[model samples]
Target: MKMADEGRRGEEDGGPGAVHQVFVVMESLLEKLKVLNYEEEILAKHNMKNLSRHYFVSSPFLAVNPGEQFFLFTVIAAWLINEAGRPFTAPQEHDEPNATVSNILSELRAFGVKVDFPPSKLKSGQESSPNYPAETTEEESVIEDDAELTLSKVEEEMIEEPDDEEENVMDLEALKLRTCPTDTEASSKPEEILEATVDAAEWSLEVERVLPQLKVTVRTDNKSYLDRLQEDVGKTLEKAKERYQQASGGVTERTRVLAEISEELEKVKQEMEEKGSSMSDGAPVVKIKQSLTKLKQEIIQMDVRIGVVEHTLLQAKLKEKSNMTRDMNATNLPEPATGPFA
Candidate 1:
């Protein structure tokens, strides 16, 4: 649990929100890469450019190919995993990003680094898990020892000795010589010491004479330019805010009306789509087409029947005319007698 808490703290400390400290993490990553011999193994082998300190850092100001960054991140991660005695396959350019990130996180967790962030954060190759290199254990200890020794040496050098000028300024030997009595003074000092001649009242009067001259006074200014400027700025800001409000008073109403219009349009569009779908699925059009086809077939049959009836009537008319002619020929003697009588 303690290790987990430490790992979480480490992750939070190195998280993206700490933008100022990202360089520290990047530097650590660069050191780890150097320890892995990336200069000879990765860059030289691939004929790639040297990695910058911010190579894996995501920044809006830095334009980089995300595909290349992700691939490089995967390659380095796989190499590190292999170096840590784990057999891991390096990802390719066309590999799924989520899968690659998951695999890397799995391997990182296998090394006991707790990862709580989502895989999407790693997709840009900006955030990398902390790497613990097995080969650097002894080297790190030795480096730390050397650093401690160097620090101790620096501290020892920082310890300053007393200067001759400071000793002269103190004059401790002179003070001691004046404080200790010599042999001649020790023998004659008891009766020959001088007594005070001046009065205490005179000394106090002289001190009072110079008291006003020794007193100091400081004057304080109440009017500050910064305070005046602040008041002016505040008034200007208030006037600007009032003017802005007046100019854009109808903005909220316009936005609400536009939103309402958009909602109505969306409703109308949905209704049209529903109507179109219903018409396409309905049977009325198909039934109407079938009805029209049946009527056409019935009209064609009626025309055929009318033609047959007309042909039969014409044949009967022709037969009647022929019979009439034959009857006139058979009765030719009666017709000649009538003509003679006429």
Candidate 2:
């Protein structure tokens, strides 16, 4: 449990740049739990409290019940194992802690993740227990990668058209040869004199022959360009107007709707504030406590009354039995005497 506390301390002391690995694992586990619908599957079914984003994170300052944490850990681990296509018995509250941890670790290893920590570390249900979900996620990712590769191969085989970009690619070696001067051309004899090889008249004639081909004419028609620009602007404006109408119904209508929504929001906020204040006022709690006190007093009074009634019933039965016995003895003696005297 101190692992989470230590991570928080490190984050605080090391500034914003510090991140803890335990938190990362916990966050990943939380996401996996969400995917598994733990809210409905576990919490709601068991009538347990909803888990927090950092429910798995343990800190001494937080009053987290260790038994609850351990139970949640076992439940989530069993669920994740089942999700990973493995058969695992869900752990019960009476299950031995060490055995539960061992089973979870066994499942994690079955998923191909190494367990370096002892089972005791998992006893807290925070440090190492969350690793099971991460292992399942990794295995799923590997499976997805394999599936993707298979799909890619199938797509490649199904492709009927050649790639135009591949066909359009130019020969880099030919281009290099044309652009780069050869070693022989770059090298010159040490004793050779540097001179112009071409005649000026022939060069001038060759330049004139190629110059016409290089002289490009780009005609600019401002009227046509302006017309096209205006058309494009008009189309863009029309699209904007249509989108605006679809999105907002009109500016005035939108403003009125917004005002109504704002008014409703304010009312809701006020109601929420009032409820919050009432809940925090402790009146309900006081009333419940008073009711419990009154019930206890009533229970004590009922117990006294029941005891008195039972005692009175017992005395009355004893007295009636004594009176019947005396009457029986007197009747037997007198009947014998009257018969003899008569």
TM-score of each model, in listed order: 0.33, 0.37
Q: Provide the overall lDDT of each model, using Cα atoms, as 2-decimal numbers.
A: 0.61, 0.66
lDDT of 2 at 36: 57
Tens-place lDDT per residue, model 1, 235-312, is 999999999997787787888999999999999999999999978885878888999999999999999999999999
Could you tell me which 10 consecutive residues in candidate 1 have the lowest summed lDDT?
1-10
Question: For model 2, how does the per-residue alpha-carbon lDDT over 221-284 read when each residue is reduced to its tens digit?
Answer: 9999999999999999999989987776677787999999999999999999999999999899
Model 1 misplaced regions, further than 4 Å:
1-18, 125-342
**Which portions of model 2 show Cα errors greater than 4 Å?**
1-16, 19-21, 125-342
Could you tell me the TM-score of candidate 1? 0.33
**Looking at model 1, how many pairs of residues clash?**
0
